[model samples]
Target: MPMLTDTIKEKLSSIQGLVFTEINNYPCIEVPKEKILEVAKKLRDECEIDQIRDVVGVDRFTKNDRFECIYNLYSHPLKIRIFLRVKLDSKNPEVESLCPVWSGANWMEREVYDMFGIIFLSHTDLRRIYMMDEYQYYPLRKDYPLMGLPGAVQLPKK
Candidate 1:
């Protein structure tokens, strides 16, 4: 059996500045900020990725200016999948949502935007999907500081 990672790396090595990563032990390709949409197109057509499984964002609060948009794609016929992760700086953690190519992405992208507070430029019908209107922070963001009920137990202090 051919190594999936090597095959993909060799095929995409020409996509300058592209990096490959492993997500949840699966093959993941990371494209440069400027090349996201282009790469997505290539992956869909030339690479035969027919399905957009999910679109979500990851918050790396430990690092300054750290955010990422992740796309999981697969092809039923080929039984192969690839993960595309696009890194964006916190100053402008925005990306062009590939809703045009994959209509299913419409809801997924909006949900990600709602949770990460990262704007997806050109994403049709971009709005708060899960949260109520005027909600301030992105709940899934690591920096959001998820906490339990306030003062669940009292502590004696001197």
Candidate 2:
């Protein structure tokens, strides 16, 4: 629940192209997809952000960058939580996996990939969590119909 300290801010500022901002008073870092792995490593190794609380994907259909990946990170020792966000291209939204830094990220990354169709490069067990493997559409996407596409997924007969 703690806010980012001046020391942590200074450390984060050294990383080129990383924009440090706040949303609702919570520190958020917007990093380029190419630098996400490197920045994540720095955060874990240098900033002591040891855990990723959650991974979320956002569909920005109207924006030029149609996808976004957000990582909620926590520093247990400091009792601080921060957000890392990456914008992705609409045609092929992809980003490097952070499983190497934190093993717990494996499942979280997979969930994002499954729901958003955002490929997590180098994720060992990247697969669907809720939808079946043959499911074609990403239900969470803005373009998806509220009632869902008929025949998109086959349900067991009751």
Candidate 3:
């Protein structure tokens, strides 16, 4: 994949509170949670990022701001991809929804919410994608029990 052009780098750098860096040769931006929406908008409008490949959640189980959200974006025209990483508080993992900028982010965001318990604010239909609506536990968190929570959800008998 091609790296971000100097012009693109300049544009991205203009966004306040964004740290531009590269991971495995692909451009990655560390964005503050409060500036996520603004950065997403700039990427779409000014950078021509047309697709959001995926939204991934990470659980760094230690202390202080343990949750993170990584948004994988692709610019079809530029043939380049970039990652937007945002850290969230472990106590309340919530961030603005990118669905407003990329409609395709809907299900991706929901999946992150479903598995990681990270809430996407203003998401059109933020609900459990795999688990039942009443399900309380997030199965993918590092702290989740290996065997699963007892009586959290009853299985159907054959």
Q: Please, what is the TM-score per model?
A: 0.82, 0.92, 0.93
TM-score, cand. 1: 0.82
For every candidate in turn, the CA RMSD to the true structure comes to: 6.4, 2.2, 1.9
Per-residue lDDT for 33-62 in model 1, tens only?
788888877777766678999986888875
- lDDT by residue (39-148, candidate 2, tens digit) is 89988998899999899999989667899999999999988888999999898898999999989999998889888899999999998998889898888999998999
Quality of model 2 by C-alpha lDDT: 0.88
Clash tally, candidates in order = 0, 0, 0
Best by TM-score: 3
Which of the numbered candidates is closest to the native, going by highest lDDT? 3
User: Candidate 2 regions off by >4 Å?
Assistant: 1-3, 155-158
Q: List lDDT for all candidates, in order.
A: 0.79, 0.88, 0.89
Ranking by TM-score: 3, 2, 1
- lDDT ranking from best candidate downward: 3, 2, 1
Candidate 1, superposed: residue stretches over 4 Å from native: 1-13, 147-158
The 10-residue segment with the lowest total lDDT in model 1:
147-156
